[model samples]
Target: MPQYSIKDHLYESQLFINRSIAAAIIVTLMLLLLGVRMVYLQVVSHEHYTTLSKDNRVKLQPLPPTRGLIYDRNGVILAQNLPAYSLEITPEKVESLEQTIEQLALILPISEEDRRRFKKLRRQRRPLRQYPDPSTPER
Candidate 1:
């Protein structure tokens, strides 16, 4: 049997209390630092981050000015402007493009000549280009 002394018990209790206090202080400091970092990002750096997020969204641009109208020798409009209707499709919105194209071919009166013309134009266009030519009426 070991004889317990008052000094030994007091020293042990003091050591345990000191370790507990150190652990509590470390945890509290970590929490405070985490809260401060969160506040900084949400409040101080919010505008910069918000702008970055907005930059990722789509941007629209207007077309440049049209060319001058051509005139004949008699000062009459020769190559005058004609009212044209244009339609555009965003590739991101289309699904199953091959199937859609096949369906379109069935619905529209696209001739064999038109398909060949499309193929020739497709070869000339950039690789990333997905939309059909705006010049084509049945596209």
Candidate 2:
């Protein structure tokens, strides 16, 4: 059986000081590592990240070709292109999409349902779509 003194204040303070010095060293190392990483990212890797951000800011999407009616030798349409009126607005071109929609509502007699559908479809950004037959004349 080993017995230790309860009144060892100097030993306790020495242990505390040792632990404190170790903790300080660890914290200082972590801070130095963090600072080095920050410097690398901000200085060395700055241009690479800047170009990536710029590329992301401006995206190029090709417009799909309009499907024209394909005819056979015997005056029969092998394939027919559906009639549709597509309106495309680049988000970057428009300052305010909501305001543009409001302006369009005045001209196009658009309702809340139409506005809601437009908003929903705008997120999709489908360039072209086929519309159902509504007394469409054959071309």
Which one is best on TM-score? Answer: 2
Q: Rate the local accuracy (lDDT) of all candidates.
A: 0.69, 0.68
The TM-score that candidate 1 achieves is: 0.40
Over 1-139, each residue of candidate 1 has an lDDT whose tens digit, in order, gives 9998566888899999999999999999999999999999999999998998888874555565487689989999977666554433444456864565566667666567766766666667665565453336654
Q: TM-scores of the models, in the given order?
A: 0.40, 0.48
Model 1's C-alpha root-mean-square deviation from the true structure amounts to 9.6
In the range 43-120, model 2's lDDT, one tens digit per residue, is 999999999999998666666657778999999999885545434456556688678767766666666666566556
